[model samples]
Target: MNFLLHCCPVHHVMVLLFTTMVAMEFGQGCTQITTCVPGQPMINCSVVTHDSNSDPPIQITSYVLENIPPNSVIYCLNDSAFFDTPGTVTYAASSDFTINDAINAVLLIRSPNREADDQITGRVTAFDTPDQSEANLQVIIIDVNEFPPEFIAPDVLQHSLRFTEGERPTNSLVGRIQTSDVDIEDSESTVSFRIKGNGGDEFNVTRMTVGPISFSNLLYTYDSPLDRERIAFYQLTIVAVDSISPVMTSNPSLQVNITIDDINDNAPQFMGDHMFFIPEGLEEGVFVGNVSASDPDAGENATITYSIASSTFDREFTIDSTSGILRTSSFYKDLRFADNMRRLTVEVMAEDNGVVPLNNRSVFTVVVQRPVRFTNNIYMFELVENNNPLVTVGNVSASSPDLVSFYYHIESPGSDKFTIDRNTGKITVQESLDRETSPMEMFIIAAVYSNHSDLSSTAIVRIIVIDVNDNSP
Candidate 1:
């Protein structure tokens, strides 16, 4: 009977060892723990073991893994002695992971996100028939530089800004740029900004903190003066980059378009000499002269209009507002009747078309002149015969209303007997004369003319020789 008992215990031990070997070969069983040998009877046990292919804790980088299949195994759990006795092993985990009942494995149902936390702690429970085992399934999510800096404020990706030329002061804030990064905090903190393009020389960027939360902002400021006449438009690109090694820049960079507006900063200026001359007795609508002005501004600021501001002969002259042509008005008359030489002072104004108009004034001197004429047409002069040479005789005088000097000459025959002064109309005897040789009453014609005019006057002069009778018969 004792031999029988020993044989029966050996058989039971062999059967238990066979079941454990089969469960281990299949790799879908509990932990194989030998409590007895060939001479001892087996004790029923429930044990859970980790598969060689799976580790207790799983590790991966955030945002690196994508599209993991449902029920994807991250960890495997097995019972070593399930073949010897009827026992089932079930697996469970925290919210970060799920259990696959068919394979008794832990699955990565939810991906690890470093944004939530760097480390995730989850309990993986393995439940056997009568006992359960719990293991910490720690998921270490590594941080990675994934996304580049992105612009958020200045909500529109592209911007257009306008300012009047010379209106904005240097270092004035023109715009604000705000950016965000979806990466980890360290990456977001390392974001910086810069400007690129041909127009960058006129602008600058500065970092600033705003709001109670100290939000980061990039301020776009004017660095140089803007002139609409010089440069009217500017194009720039705004780029954002992180300070991390192998820096990442923003994709599809932001654009900044700047436009310069015009202002009436330049006043109209008169051009050329402002002196003019016109003759008297000019008909109405006679073109006197033209006055012109120029401005170095654009658009309406440069448009010019002309007018006669003040004049000595105000009602006698008229000026075209658009063409700047000055003309005689209906009130114009012969100025020579009033004054032989008349000079008029005219004040001309040139104004620009602007919101607040600007103007310039200039003075023009206009002179009026008349034809030269004499005051007398006839004169009488008396001289005695047998007078000594160079003897003075009566003078024949003439004048011009134009205030011009005259030259006189004798135009009649027998004039050589007497000489006349060119500057003054004084008659003098050239030689002694007797009454028989020359006529008793001599009539001579004298002419007076001016170098300034072709018009002249003639006068008749009679010289009656006295009968001195100094002739030898």
Candidate 2:
């Protein structure tokens, strides 16, 4: 029985050995372990030292394709599983975007990503050829600031500053974003940010530095409000570039709008088409017209002034300033034997207070009118010294060129003014006269002699009143 027990023990040992060897073919550390980082050589280690229960834990680190070309076959001894790999492992990023295929097959970097602290995690499937896959490794690649600095939150960029003629944003922080690849924190992975948008007057990158920031330049300065009073607003673009080129993800240059504060720059000016009107029989001093203009500038620049450019009217016409009025400057006889004229051509000017001193001027024309006059006085005697008067008196005689040679009919002016004998041409006063109201006056009118036109030389006449004294002074 003791011998039987020994044989059983030997069989049990053989069974245990077989089971351990079989298990070692598939588990960690029985044969070789491949460290994912730094391309460490594959090594064979005893299975007992496998870290199945380590504390902080060791995970498969970021692995890049070794010296092999893309689509080249590689036999892998990872932990204990043998995986034959072909084709390149792709580093998938966010939705719909990825590192280029060429970058995928080798160690290449992604531009500035939208965030930091993210892992370059992706699926690495082993394929026998570029077109086929059998086993897959969910590889996790650590991330650092492989991407340059950029603005991200809000998906918007903003800046504020006092604006001048050439003013713009400078060293102020626009914003910050994350990266695509993570290297050791101390490595050159901390990419720097900069600007190319400031383009000075030509829209050069006027103000730029190697970091994320916000600021303004005094290149353009203004002591007063902007010329918005002259022109209203402006649009500008700002640019941002990076220290690391491939690490290009940055806020695109944003457009900024600036509104100019208004200040007066123009003055009121008058249009050229001005006209004048002089009332019929207008008094010499009566005002006839007014003037006006417009200003393109504001405030004090817009104020206006009025004056007589050219007034044909005399002192009789006057103008009121604020009301744009024209009144009689000095009253004058509206009635005159001679024509009264108020016609005039004149010019006026409006000026503005700008550095260049701008001004507006215009011309206007005025019209004048005249009146009629009459002559007075009449005399008479049996025989006077060749004297003629406008009216006839009691015993005196006077005649018109058509009426006198002998007589006249009351149907004509000469007959209406004097009663006359046709044969003797002796005329007498037909109506009483008042010197003040209806003073004796002479009027030369053509008179007809024969039934037809028998014209004669214009003649003279005289009329004397017997002084019945019907008129009162």
Candidate 3:
């Protein structure tokens, strides 16, 4: 005869019952035998779960059985479960198959010496029945490998590194990448480091092993020279990867920032050669022109100042320390030459405000020309007292060695009666002149360059008015 078992759930408790019975027997009174008999007890259980290397024992409900006669008992066939290693799985209970007055069992799973088995099986039996029934109990130990790699030393996550440009050589240690894994039992997991993102090509990482420990160091490869003027700061990502079947990288990444400090490696250079023109006799402190320079460095290394390093004339010019504007000094009035044309060569220096102070020099050529001069110092003329207005008095002339045009004007007293042509230098009487009221009219004539009023010369002229009277007595 065949017997069938069925499982039922009641209030979080699982109960297994033998539904079909084969034969029956009576013990009291007459000896009677029937086709029906007591069925064997049945046991049913769920798989118990636990972590491979964790603290605290796992607790699960004990198996419940039905179809058992009176005075029957339930117990485990063996004390431990069978797996790759013995004694890894064990169970604890109070009295009989109850724990803390409840039908719960405590399962203890020790830390595995090596890779642990996925599951372990044990046998549970119900005795004292017509025929004993056995069932299998399973315990699954899950491998705990959940932590990702992390950077510890130098703490790239909190701080950055700084280096002076051209100070360090290739293969120099930039920083050490110290890392650890909380799942220390997982000896199979190995961590490797690498560089990523911009400026990563200029650096490299190397892993080294000392004894049973391994670590990585970030190095300055110098594949491309560092220039603070070209690029001042660089940001690179440091990634730590573990050698698991499915690799795991560091979360949020380790950002390694590097700042290149500036040095006075570049010299101040003039923007271009400067040339200027200034007429003679200009007052001191006249602005000539600007002389500019620039530096590509940062901070004080780029601050530039200008100065007159050398000049053909002493104390002839001055320059601004910060603005680089060139100005004339005391020698401005004495710049004229006998040939009426003179050039001054000035050497200007542009220096940066560094500790060592790098500098550059440039030459500036300034042309100074003499003022216009009159041909005669004085001129005498006579005019009739009753001469008509707009009559020609006399002609005065001046010349410039530079061949520039001239402008003429009267500068002395009694100049209102006479007018001079600015371009032609011709003097004329604007109104009739009287010898009785003003016998002699003395005035000064001034000539200046058309473009440069500062370059000028002066001359004297005397006009005598003859008396011619027509008496109307």
Candidate 4:
């Protein structure tokens, strides 16, 4: 075995001074032993500081073996700690010394624990036949923050939230966003927050300073006003990024769901004008028309109940609660059936059921009139000449408030020449007549009996007869 110093000029001087001190302290008791052991002249190499969290089998530094003997071997001796530990640091080897035995052999050191920063010592030894020599190696572990920040809770927020429809106070805390980083000693492990996904701009996350600190109290606030009728819910993502260089690496993200609570903020309105014209004498409980309205709210806040809030004849009219159907009430029979037109004004109310109920009102105008024989007051027809006996010359139509039967007859110049059907008010020629002797004029009276008496209406007909040449006298 041979003792040799292999290093740069700087470390070479430190190794000599350190060796002299150790030798003087221990005197001849530390003999120049020609054997591989723990306390030996450490060929001072460079000060090696490696990054923690590096992969296994990381290189610390290398040493060189000078002037080796033939058929001799060089290897690492067991250190008290990491280097020779069974699983921590195994498989240590120096560049093959046998192949180039005459020249200096480079020593290469490696360990499998790449993420550890514990300061430990390592050793390497050389052997020649029965002789051996050993050297001490110095290694320093530097901590590095490589892992990103993560949410302390689930990737999705566990708490569901809700807010009213309005602007929130400035800097008002809506909720807390919690996070953590595993790197304790790293200054760059501080976590900052950002909101993303849809409606991200509606909220603001608290800012954090750059340094090692807990990010568990990151509170979020509402930045913009809310309208439940326009937008009901929001789905968003919260991202936590470390203050370290290159913000994207290992950044954590999570989803948060929020809903806007409803409010009865809108009023009801009628679809059109409320005026209506109905014939007189309609039966009780018959539907007249509908009054409709709507609300801009959601759920129970928009559900509306209706009522006939006021009317000139309250006892004669009614409205449905759910459907808003206007109808004649049971007391409609109590009203007088008069010959003149009557007018009634009604007000309908629509109300919503919410945390705070709201209401609206609308006016309805109803006109009632007696039944008439026809929409038009006057009716006339020209008679064609030489018609068959049963030929219908014309028809007289009528309208009524209620379904009622009518009778027909020829009033003025009642003659056997023409007749009217009692059921249909159709006038037909009873017999063929000569234009020379017939009066050429006639009238029809359409009548319906009320209280066993005839209530009549009238129409006219003129028979214009043409002479045939074959009938010349």
Say which prediction, candidate 2 or candidate 3, comes out ahead on TM-score: 3
lDDT of 1 at 81: 25
Query: What value of lDDT does candidate 3 attain over all alpha carbons?
Result: 0.63
Query: Model 2: per-residue lDDT, tens digit, 10-95?
Result: 11000111111233232322223222222222211112111335421222223222222332211122322212342333333323
Cα misplacement distance, residue 423 of candidate 3 (Å): 21
Off by over 4 Å in 2: 1-114, 118-207, 210-230, 234-257, 261-267, 283-287, 309-317, 323-328, 332-342, 349-361, 369-473
Candidate 4 lDDT by residue in tens digits, 193-284: 67776677767666444475433432434444677777788777777776644343334467777788887787765676576655556779
Give per-residue CA lDDT, model 1, range 1-473, as digits (tens): 01100111112101223223223422243234323222122222222333434453222211112223444444445443222343676666788778766555556676555556655566766567687655555544434445678877665433887878976643466766667766636433567767777567666655654553433433435454678877778788888897643467899788888888889989998898677756677889988889989998889999999999999867779999999998988777654436733778789999999999999999987766454333455555556666788888767776655565568777766577777787777877778867666655455544443442334566666666667656588
Collision count of model 3: 4
- Regions more than 4 Å wrong, model 4: 1-115, 118-148, 154-157, 162-171, 182-190, 208-227, 242-252, 263-277, 296-300, 330-343, 367-473
Candidate 3 residue-wise lDDT at 193: 71
TM-scores, each model vs. reference: 0.43, 0.34, 0.49, 0.48
lDDT of 3 by residue, 294-410 (tens): 999999999998888999875889988999998889877675675534778889999999999999999988877667888998988888888899999899989987777779998
lDDT of predicted model 1: 0.61
Residue pairs with clashing backbones, model 1: 29-78, 29-79, 29-80, 30-79, 30-80, 31-80
Q: Judged by TM-score, which candidate is best? A: 3
